[model samples]
Target: MYKETLSSGIIIVPMQQEHAEQLEALQRIVFPNLAEEELLHADQYKKHVELFPEGQFVALDGDKVIAATSSIRYHFNLNDNEHHTFFEIMGGGWFTTHEPNGEWLYGMDVSVHPDYRSKGIARALYRARQYTCKQLGLKGQMTVGMLNGYAAVSDQMNIDEYYKKVKNHELFDPTVSVQEKVGFEIVGLMKDYLNDPTCGNAGAVIVLDAGKAI
Candidate 1:
């Protein structure tokens, strides 16, 4: 009833009743400082609940789920095409934007337990998710990432300086090269939009496309 695959000597599959605790623990460690509304807690499991049947995947060593990725399906209508579904967003859960529901999957909220870092678990999990998306006939996937606030301004708006004043750090700079290695395209930026108060400013929004796969 569930999809199964093996990676790096570990078993990867769709999460089931046995993985509730492991998933909860993973969320706590990966998302600790955010508020209730800002945070994605176990209570919100319903948002991703049904996806387990069609959109969730996990990487496990023995009985331990070390890495995970959740898939989201968004429906969108292409501007040029005649009411056709073209955009789908997916990622490791670090970000979420418009819901582009179509023949596509949005990869969201990816995490690797600290103890198991740098072990290729994440890469394996990502591939499995991609495989699932393709199997379901999704043409591609989309994702967004946090970036610096300086370049988020438009000449008409002239809000670049305000962006810097809001966020004091450049930690989320999307200009970095690492994000490129994973097949993403920089699309847009949101300035002082998040209002994190703590992080000081809003973050950048990058779009990644996973080209057609067979």
Candidate 2:
């Protein structure tokens, strides 16, 4: 039941079952290209809260949910041999993979409504994640960041080069660039991370150290 008020009057708080429908509606707008199978249905939100309520959060303006982020705990090793895809790591959207004694917070998704873009809502959600990591004494945070806006240049560059460009500030990927700004570093890329054709069926493995955030 954490709460914070942003300067713009948006309120950030732990997600509740009451927010399920609003969260599902916002997900449609925020991730319009996501496959139906990949999207979490409204009922799943209740499972998320029951499993790990502390890692689920939402941003609201009045009664409307404008942004949200979900995370799960997992014993992750960056050098592990198992080449887990996003779906495998997330337990098919139900997050049944969440391990109670895990070392890292695996960020499942961070979404902001189309109307709330560029308003710092996403960053605020990330800061909340960092706070959670610090409080729980977790190692850090991990995510498969979307390479939004990568389709336009996919024919001109490979995924690695595109990631480098985003890291070096040579490219302005809508998702990765913003993630890099918040301290996540690209460890590598994964194939078939999502159903989005725009990103060339790739996603970046990004990590942020909790000590640095603290």
Candidate that scores best on lDDT: 2
Q: Summarize candidate 1's per-residue lDDT along 1-214 as a digit string, tens digits.
A: 3444554577777766566568767867764643434444453344465444467677788898777777667653333212211121222222243243556565555677888766666656666666766667766654433333334443323444443433343234433223444554444444443324332333333344455221
Candidate 2 per-residue lDDT, tens place, 174-204, comes to 8887788888988877777888977877788
| Candidate 2 Cα misplacement greater than 4 A, ranges | none
Worst 10-residue lDDT window, candidate 2: 80-89
- What is each predicted model's overall lDDT from 0 to 1? 0.51, 0.86
Q: By TM-score, how accurate is candidate 1? A: 0.63
Evaluated with TM-score, which candidate comes out highest? 2
List the candidate 1 regions with Cα displacement exceeding 4 Å.
Answer: 1-8, 76-101, 148-177, 191-203, 212-214
